[model samples]
Target: MAKTIHIALVGNPNSGKSSLFNVLTGLNQKVGNFPGVTVDKKVGSCQLADGLNATIIDLPGTYSLYPRREDEWVAYRVLMQQDKEVVEPEMVVLIADASNLKRNLLFASQIIDLKIPVVVGLTMMDIARHKGIQIDVAELERELGVPVIPINPRKNKGIQPLKKAIEQTALELYKAPVRDFINNEALAPAAIGSVKELFPELSDYKAIHYLINHESFALHGHLQEKIESIEQVNNFNHTKTQAEEILQRYQRIGSILKQSVSEPSPLKKTLFTEKLDNIFLHRRWGYIILLAVLFLLFQSVFWLAEYPMNIIDWGFGEISSWLGNVLPSGWFADLLINGIWAGLGGILVFIPQIMILFGLVTILEDTGYMARISFLTDKLMRKVGLNGKSVMPMISGFACAVPAIMSARNIENKKERLLTILVTPLMSCSARLPVYTILIGLVIPKTMFAGFLGLQGLVMMGLYLLGPIMSMFVSYIARFFINIKEKSFFILELPVYRAPRWKNVLITMVNKAKIFVFDAGKVIMVISLILWALSTYGPKEKMRSVAARYEQQIKQHPEQEAELNRLKNTELLQNSYAGLLGRSIEPVIQPLGYDWKIGIALITSFAAREVFVGTMATLYSVEGGDDADENTLMEKMNAAVRPDGTKVYSLATGISLMIFYAFAMQCMSTLAIVKRETRTWKWALIQLVYMTGLAYIMSLIAYQLLK
Candidate 1:
C-alpha cells in the first residue's frame, strides 16, 4: 500500500507471457484502453509475501524495441512511460523462452540497455529440457546481469521466486547484475553524444534510443526541434545505426550463450512436437485432421450440450406452466409467465453449447494448435488475396464479429486487412448459435451417421462453415474491383506444445457464458417485452370489431365454437401491432417460405442474430394464449400453422432461414465496428448492402430449390 510497484511483463510472441501474467495476477486483472490507442491496457495487482502489492501490466507481446505494429507501439510507449494511461514501471519482467533463448535474449538485451531495472523470468524450461537443451540459470543470470528465474506458470511452479525477484529488483531500482550487454561507447557513440547533450539526464542506452526513434518519440516543440537539428547536424542514419547495434549485440549474445547454455546434437532424437506435427501439419493428413477437428467441434456442440439443453427447456416449460396455473388470470400474469420468462429461458438454454464451444477453443489455443490452424489455412487465405495472418481474424470471427474485425488491424497489409474486415462477418459467430440450434432441432432429424457423427451435428457444422466458405468466395470476387497493390507477408512461430491449462480453459468458458447471459440476455429481455406488448394490443376500432364478430360467430355456431375461438385468436393477432408489422414484411420474406410470424422474428433479429429465438418464444407464447402448457420453444414453433393450416417451419423454410443468417450482416455492433475500424461509413455501408443482397439471393435460391 505504501509503495505501488509497477512491473511490466514483456516478451516476444509465443513466449508464455500471457500464462505468466495470468498466474502472477490471477483474477486481479482488469482490461482498459490505453491512451490514444485501441490496444487493450491489461493491468493486474498481486500481493507479495511481505504484504507489498505490485501492479503488473501485461504489455502486448512484441519482438524488439523498434515498433512496427500498433500493438508493438503500445508496448514500446508504455515501457518508455510516454503515455498518460501507463504508469512508470518500477521493474521490467522479461519473459524469456528458454527453448528460444537466442532470439528472446536479443529483446532482453535491448531492455537492459534501456537501464530500467530488469529481471528475466525464464520460461519453458521443461520444453527446453525435452529438446535436449540445458541452461545454467545462475550463469545465464550472471551473463545477462539479471535474475533469470526458471518458472512454469502453466504448472504453477517457481512463481513465488518470480514474485520475490520482482520485489527485490524493485527495491534495488531494477539494477541489472551485468549492466552493459554491449559496449555502447563504440556503437553509435557520436549519435548518443548528440542526444545526451540535448537531454543531459539520459542513460547511454536511452540516449541512443532517442537518436534512433527521435522522430516518433514524445518530445515536442523546442525539444523536438533541437532533436531534429541534432539529427541533421550529425547525419544520424537510423537504419545504419540499428543494423550496427544489432550486429554488436548478437556478437556478445553469442559469446554469453556459448558459455551458459548447451544443446545436444540435433541428429540424436526427435521431439514429441515433431512427432505430432507429422500428422497435424502433414501436407495431406493435416487438412484431413483439420476438417475432422472442426467436424468434431460442431458435432460435440450439439451432442454434448443436448442433455443439458433438454433439461433447461423442460425446466422452463414446467415453470411457465406452473406460473400460469398459480397466478390469477390477467394480462400482467400472462406477460410475466409467457413473454419475459419464456424469452429468457430460450436464451439461457443455449448456455451449455456456448460453454462447450469456448472451452474447446481455449484448449486448442493452450496446446498451440491454433497456430497450426492458421498455418494450414494460409494457402486458402492467399487464394482470397489474403495470407496466413488473416486467419486470426477469421478464426476470432467465430466468437463475435466486432472484436474479430478489430483484430484485423494485426494484418499490416492495408488491402488484405480491409478485405479481412469486410468478410469477417461471414464467419458464423456465437450470436448465430441460437438461430442454428432451434432450427437444427426443428428440422435436422436426430440420427447418427457413421456410428459417431450425428446427422444434426453435420447440419450444424455445415452451417458454421457456410459463412467462411462464402467469405472466401466473396473476397475472390471483390479483389478485382478494389485494387490496392500491396505485398502480403506472414512469418509465424509455432510455439512448443504444452498441456492444456484447465484453470485458464474453465475461466474462458465461464467468462464467455457470463457475457452471453448478462449482456445478450438483457437485449433479449427488452425485445421480448416490446414484442409481447405489440402482439397483445391492437387499434381500438379494429380490436373491437374483431372481438364482436368472433363473439357473434361463436354464439351462432356453438357446435363449432372451438373453430370460432381459433379464428378469433388469429384475427386478434392480425389486427395487433406486431402482426401488422410482420404482415408488412411478409410479402418480401414469404417467397423464402416464412409466414407473418417468422417475418416478425426476422425483423427483430436485425438487432442481433440471436434475438430471433427470443422473438419467436414471446410471439408464439402470446399466440398459444394464457394456458398452462409445458411446450418448449421448439415444440411450440413446430405446432405453429398459418391461417390456411399449413406448417410455419417447413424443411425448406428452416434451411432457407439458416442460409440467410449465415450470410447477412444482421448485427448492428458488427456494422458499428466496421465503421470504426475503417474510419468511415463508406466501407461499412458497402458491406451492409453487399452482405444483405447476397443473403437475400441465397435464401431465395435455397427455398426455391428445396421447396
Candidate 2:
C-alpha cells in the first residue's frame, strides 16, 4: 500500500510558496476554508516516490509564528498542532528567498527551534546573484541543521531533488535539534518551565511561545489562569522579551552568515527594482502610466474578444435552430430551446471577455506592477481614511467582492479593514461585465479617436474606475462615525519586475472560464428554467382567454398567419405569470426607464448580478418568433419596444441601468461574505441599504436628466 504522509509549505509573503505549490501539485489541488475560519486552505496530493504519497498543505504566508491577523493565527494553530481539524505536517518545507536570507532566516531559525523536520527550499538565487550576493548552500544547511535545497520552482529547477528530500525526511523519524537556534531557555527561563509543566511534550521554543501567546491559544479557562499567574509571578514584559529574543536571533544569524554567505556593501550598488521605480513609481508619470495600462486592459477586453464572442453566439443560435427543427413541436421542445438553451447561451457568450480580463490582471500581478499600483495610490488612499494595503482588496474587487472582502484580513487596522470590506462591492466585479458590455454596446458608439483610442473601451474603463472613486468618498465619510481609534501604517514590499509566466496566465484564464461556465452556469440554468415556466404559463383563466382571443384573430386573418402568430406569442407572454410579477414592480422602476420585463430581471438578478443577462434571454426567447431569423439577446434588446412604441433600451435607459448596476449591492453572496468577515449583520445591513439607496438615487438622476 502507498501510505500518505503530510507535508506543509510555509514562507513569508511573496516568498514563492504558492508558486512552488502550483509546480508540485499541478492540477491535483483543491481550495477551501479552514475549520471555523474563512482563511483559505489549499491542499493537494503529490506522488513523492513509489509507495510514498504526500499530501501537501500550503499554509498562509507570515513573517513569523507570532500571531496578529486571522490568517497568521491559522498558520500558527496548524504549526503548533493545536487545531483539532488540521493535522500537523510530518515535514515542513521552509521556502526562503536567497536574495534576503537574513530576514528569511529569522523565521527559519524559529521553526528549527520547534524541533520539527525542516527543509529549506532556497528561491530567487538568480536574483540574489544579480544583486552581487552569494550563498554556499551546504554551509547554510549545516549551520541551520536541515537539508537546504537550492531550487527555483518557477523555472522547474531542482524540484525533483526537493521532492526526494521531502520523501526521505518524512520516512525517517524526526530528530530534535541538538542545540537551540538561539538561547531560548535563557530568554525567559521561569515562564518556559511553568508552561512546560502544563504541556510536558513541548520543546523549549514552543514553551516560550505558549507563555507569550497563551491568550490566543485554544486553552481551558483554568489553564489560561495558570499561564497568567506564571506571567504575573515572573514579572514578564511581553514587548521587552520579544525584542530581546529577536535581537539575540539576529546576532547568531549574523555570525552564521559570515561563514556561509557574502554580499556587496549596501552603499556601493543600487538594485534593479530601485532603478525601475524611477519611472513606474514617479509621482506624476506613475499615474499616467497607470491610466494607460488600465485603458489598454479594458480595450483589449473588447478588441481581442469580439471574434470569439460572435462565434459563440452564432454557434448557439445554429444549435437551437437545429434542435427546434429536429424535435417535435411540443412543451418539452419549447422548454429545452427557449428556457434552458437560451439562458445558457446568454451567459456563455461572455466567456471570452472574462478570460481576457483575468489574463491581463494576472500579468500585472506576475510582473509586480500591481504592488506599485498600491504604492502610487497610497497617498490618495490615506486621504480617504485608508492606506496602501486597502488598494489591493479594492482592486481585487474587480474579480469578485466575496474574495476581495476576505482578503481584507491582511489589513492590520480593524477600522480600515472594515471600511474596505464595506465598500469593496461598489467596485465592478466580473459579474457586472456582461451587463456593462451589453448596455454599453447599446448606448456608446464604437468610434475610434486618433485612429487608436476606442470610445466604447474608454467608457468601460470609466465604469471600473467609478467604484474606487466612490469607495474613497464613502470611506472618508464613514470613518468619522465608526469610533475605532488606532494608529494605522502602510508598509509594503515591492517585488522586482519579471516577465509573466505564460503557462500560469493560460491556466488562470482557463480556470476563470470554467468557474463562469460551471458555477455561474448552474445559477443561470435554474433561473432560466423557472423563468421559462413563468413566461410560458399564466393563471388558468387568463391563459385560456389569451389562447381563445389569439385563435379568433388567426381565424379572422388567415391570410396574415405569420404576423398574427408573432402577435399572439407576444400577447401570451405579456399576460403570463412572469409578466404579472414584473408588472407589480413596474411602478417603482418605471422612472428609471425600465418596463415590467426588465423589472422581473432586476428582482431575480438579486441572487447574482450576471443572472440579469440570463433572465433577459429567457423573457425575449419566449416572446421571439420561431422563424430561423431570430437575433441574439443584444439585437433583441435593441429592437424591443415599450407599450408607447418607443425603444425599450434607449440611450437614457441603457446608461441609467449601467449606472444602477455600478452602485447596487445586488449580490447576496457578497452580503453574506461581508457579514461573515465583519462578524456583524449591522455593518452588512448598512452596506446593503446605503449601496442600494445610492444606486437608486444616482440612476434616477441620470435617467431624468437624459429623458
Candidate 3:
C-alpha cells in the first residue's frame, strides 16, 4: 500500500486560503482541534493519482514566521517541526495573494528559505489585473526558483495544474531551488553555525528561529538552557536580527519583482475597489448603509424563509395527525408522537430561518464587508475598552458563541480579548433564533410599513441589535473592574470587495443547519423526552387519584366527556412531577409573566436555548393529547390561556420572555467553551451568574411596565 502524503497549506489572511481548501476538499473535510490546543485543525484528503492519496492540513494564516498570537504560534510550530503532536508535512502549498504581492511575498520568501519543498499558488489574479498590475508567471517562477501556479479558487480555475505542481514537488520530480530566498546563514554566522551544529537536521532559517523562540519552543530544559547560554554569550539581539532579516528579504524581493512584475504608478491608479469603498466606507454614509444592510439581512431571513418554514410546520403537523390515526393508542405510541416527534419537529421547523441567517452572514463575509464593519465600529468599540478586532468575534457570536469565543484568540491585547470573550455571549446567537422567531410571531404584527419594513423582522433585528448594545454597556462597566491596563491598537487590512460566492453561501447554510440539528438537536431531544415522562406521570397515588376522579366525572356526564377529559389532563399535568418542578419555580418567575409551563421551559432550556421550543412542544403535546390532530407548536402555543382565560402569550408576556432569553446565558456548551478558553471556572461561573441575573432583572422590569 502507498503511504498517504502529508501536505500543509499555508497562507496570509484573506489570500483565498479557505476558498481553495473548500474547492480542493469539497465535502471530504473534517474540523478538529490541534493536539494540546483549541485552535481548529481543518484536514481533508484528495486523490492526487490512482495510487496516491494526500492528506491536506490547512494551517492558520499568518503574516510572518515570527509568532505572537496563539494561532500564529500553532502555524509557526507546525511549519518549524517543533510541535511533536502534529505529523510533519513532507511538502507545503504556499498561497500568495497576487494583488498584495509585496506583503504576501514576505511570508512566502520565509517559507521557501525553511528548506521545505513548496509550490506557490498565486490567487486574486483578477483583482491584481483590475488594479493594473501585470505579472510574468514564468519569469516569476524562474526568479523564485519554484513552480508558480496562478489559481482563481472562486472560479475553480488553475486547480488541476496547481495539483499537478504539488504532486511533482512532493514526488521530488520538480527541480529544486538552487539557493535560498535570502542569505540566512550570513545574518548571525556564529550563532547560526552553533545552532545548526546542535541540530544537524535544521535549516539555517530554522536554526535562527530556535535562537529567537527557544523559550516558546518545546525543547528540553537542557537544550533551552544551552540556547539561552548561546544567546547571552553571542549578545544576540532577537529584535535586531528579525529587523535585519526582514529588510534583507524585502530588498531581495524588490530586486526580484523588478524583473518579473509591473504595475501602474500608485499616483495614477484608482482601482474599482477604491471607487466602491468611497460609498461603503464613507464616514457619514457608511453607518447608514450598514444599518440598511443589516435591516435587509434580518428582513430577508423572514421573507425568504416564510414558505419553507410554513411547509415544515405543516408537514410535521400532518405527520403527527397521521400517526395519531395510524398508530395503536398506547404509552409507546404516545411517546413516539409527543416525546420524540414533537422534539424533532420543534427543532427542525426552524431550519429555514437558521439557513437564511447563516447564508446572509456568509455573504457579508465573502463580500469583504465584514472587515469594513470592524473598521467602522473600532471607534465605538474602543470607547467600551475594546477595538476593531473585538467586532469580528462579537459578530461571529450571532452564529454561535463557542467558535466566537475561540476566535477571540486573535486579539493581541490580553485584556481586550478577555473583555471580548466575557460579553460575547450576550450577542444573541442562532440558538436564540427559534425562541425569537416563535415569540415575535406570537406577539409582533406581521404587517409591513409601506409594504417593505416588516414589524416582525424589525422586532427580530431589535433583538439582534440589543445584544451588542448591552454588550457594549457591560464591557464599559467591566473594564474598570478588570484591573489590567494595556495600550489598545486597531490595525486592519481591508480586503478588496468582491461578489459573494454562492457555493460557499449554500455550503454555510447547510452546515449551520446540520450543526443545529445534530448538536443542539441532541440536547433538545433528550430534554423533550425527559419532560414528556415527567409531565405524563407523577407521584403514583396522585396520578391514580386524578385518573379515577376523571373517570368518575366522565361516567356522571357523558355529554361533557370531552371537556372533562381536557380538564383531567390539565389537572393531572399540574400534579405530575414535571408540573411540580415547574410550579416550584413559578412563584419566582411569575413577575416575568412566565407561568408553570414557561417555567418548565426555562429549566430545561438551561441545557440550550433552542431546547425551549422543543420543551414547550413536548409539554403542550402531553397536556393537549390528541384533541387537535393537525396542531403545530405555534398553534398550540397561540391558543394557550392562563387561569383567568387571558391569552398566555399576550404582547407583554411575549416581550418579557423574549427579553429573558435575550439576556440569559442558558447554553452549557457556551459555558464549557468559556471555561476552556479562559482556563478557569471562575469566569465561566461569573458569566452565568451575571448574565442570568441581568436577564431576571430586565425581564421583571419589562413585564411590569408592559403589564
Candidate 4:
C-alpha cells in the first residue's frame, strides 16, 4: 500500500496561491465549510506516480503567522494543529510572486520555522523575465534548504515538478537539513539571543512567539516544550521582550535577502504595470470609465436577455396551455397548469438577467480590474465611513446580496464589515430587475430622450443608481453610532492583468445560476402553490350563495348573461380565502393605492421578489374565463379599478411599488447570508426592520406625493 501525502499550500494574498490550487486540482476540488465555522475549506486530490495520491488543502491567504481577521485565524489554527485529523501537513508548498519576492518572503520565513518539509513555488517567472528580473533558482533553493520551482500556474507550467517534489518528501526519499543551510549564522544567533534576554522566564518558542508578536503561538504545546529548552540555556536573562525578538528576526531576514539577491539596476522600469494603472486608477477618468462599464452591464442585462427570456416565457406558457387542453378537467390538471407551471415560469424568466450579471462580475474579477476599482474608490469610500475594501461587496450586491455579504468576510474591521453587509441588500439585486422592468414598462412613456436616453432607459438607470446613493447615506448614519478604534487601511496588490479565463468564468456563471434557480426557486414554487390553492378554493357555502344570486340576475336580464357571469367570477374571487387574506391586509396598504389582489401579491412576494408575477398569474387564472389569453395578464392588471372607480395600478402605485422593491429585504437567501456573515442575529434583524420601514415610508410618500 502506498502512503497518502497531505500537502498544504500557503502564500500571501495575490501570490497565485488560489490560481495554483485551481491548476493542480482542476475539477477535483471540493468546497465546504470548515468543521465548526462558516469559513471555506477547499481540498482536492491529485494522483501521483506509482499509485500514490496526495491530498492538497489550500489554506486561506495570510500575511504572517500573526492573524487579525477571521479567515486568517482559521489559517493559523489549521497550521498550528498537530493532530493527524487536524493540522498535520507532510509538506508545505509556499507560493511566492517572482515579481515581488521581498514582500512574499515574510510569510515564507515563518513557515520555514515550523520544521515541516517546505518547497517554494515561485510564480510569475515569465512576467519577471519580461520585466528584466533574473533569479538564480538553484542558489535560492540551496540557500533556503528547500526546492524552488519557477512556474506560472496560469500557464500550466511546472506543476508536474511541484507534484514530484511533494511525492519525494511524502515518501521520505528527500531529507534536507533544516538550519544548517543558513549562511548568516551571526544574525540568527544574535536574534535568538535577543529573544532569550527579553523574556528569560518564557520558553524559547514563547520568546520566538513574543518576537513575532504571534500571541496565538503560545497555544501550541510542542512550541511550549521547545521554548522551555531554550529558557534553560545558561546566562539567559528576562530583559528583552518577545516583540523586540521578533523585530530582530525580520531584521535578519532583510539582511539575508540583501546578501543573496542582487539587482542589475536598483530601479528598473515597470512600464507595463504602471502604464495600465495610470489610466485605470485616474481620479476623474476612472470613475467615468467605471460608470460606462456599469451602464454597459445594465444594458446587456436588458437588451441581450430579451430573446432568451421570451423563449422561456413562450415555452412555459405553451406547455401550460397544451397541458390544460390535453388533460382532463380535474384537481390534478388545475394543480399542474395553474400552480406548478406558473411557479416554474416565474423562475425561468429571471435566468437571463442572472447569467448576464454573473458573467460580467466574473470577467471583472478575473481580469483584476475589480481590485483597481476598489483602489480608485477607496478615498471616497472612507469619506463616507466605509473602507475601500467594502466596494467589492457593494458592487456584488447588484448581482445578488447573499454572496455579496459572504464576500465581506475578507474585510477585517468589524464595524465597517457589518455596515457594508447591512447596506448591501439595499443595492437592488438582480432579482429586483424583473419587477422594475415590468412596472416601468407598464407606467413609463415610450418616448426616447434625445434618441439615446429613452424614458424606460432613464428610469432603469435611476432605479439602479438609487440603491448606492441610499446605501451611502445609510452607512454614514450608521457610522455615527458605531465606534471604531482600529486602524483601517486599504492596501491591495494589483495583480498583473491577464486575459479573462473563459472556462473559469463560465463554470462560475453556471454554478451561480443553478444555485439561484434551485435554492430560491424551491421556496418560490412552494409559496406559489399554496397561494394558488388559497385563491382557487373559497368558502363553499359563500361561493354557492354568490353564484346563485348571479344566476338569478342572469335570468332577470337574459341578454346580459355573459357579463353577469364575469361579475360572478370576480365576486367569488373577492370572497375566496386568498381574497379574504388580502382584504384583511388592505387597510395597511390602501394608502399606497393597492387593491386586495395586489395586496396578496405584495404579501407573497416578501418570500422573493420574483414570486410577485407568478402570484399574480395564479390569482388571475382562478378568476378568468376558459378563453383567457396569457398576454392579457398585463392588460387585466392595467384595467383593474377600485370600488370607487379609480385605477388601482395608477402611475403613483407603479412608482411606489418600484421604490418599495428598490430598498426592501425581499430575499430570504440574503437574510440567511447576513446571519452567516455577521455571526449574530442582531445585525440581520436590524437590517430587516430598518430596510422594511424605510421602504414602507418612502413608498407611502412617493404614492401620496404623486397622487
Query: Per-model C-alpha lDDT, please?
Result: 0.80, 0.82, 0.84, 0.74
Better of 1 and 2 by lDDT: 2
TM-score of each: 0.80, 0.84, 0.84, 0.82
lDDT of prediction 2: 0.82
Q: Alpha carbon lDDT of residue 149, candidate 3?
A: 99
Error of 3 at 37 (Å): 4.5
The runs of at least 3 residues in candidate 1 whose Cα sits more than 4 Å from the true structure, single-residue gaps closed, are 32-40, 173-179, 185-191, 211-223, 309-351, 389-466, 478-488, 514-573, 586-598, 607-661, 667-687, 700-707
Poorest 10 consecutive residues by lDDT, candidate 1: 622-631
* TM value for model 3: 0.84
Query: lDDT (0-100) at residue 501 of candidate 3?
Result: 90
Whole-model lDDT for model 3 versus the true structure?
Answer: 0.84
Clashing pairs in 2: none
Candidate 2, number of clashes: 0
Instruction: State, as a TM-score between 0 and 1, how close model 2 is to the true structure.
Output: 0.84
lDDT of 1 by residue, 256-330 (tens): 999999999879688888889998999999999988886676566667877997799889988988998899988
What residue runs in model 2 are displaced by over 4 Å at the alpha carbon? 326-351, 389-468, 478-488, 510-534, 555-561, 590-601, 604-658, 665-688, 702-707
Q: How many residue pairs clash in each candidate?
A: 3, 0, 0, 9
**By TM-score, is 2 or 4 better?**
2
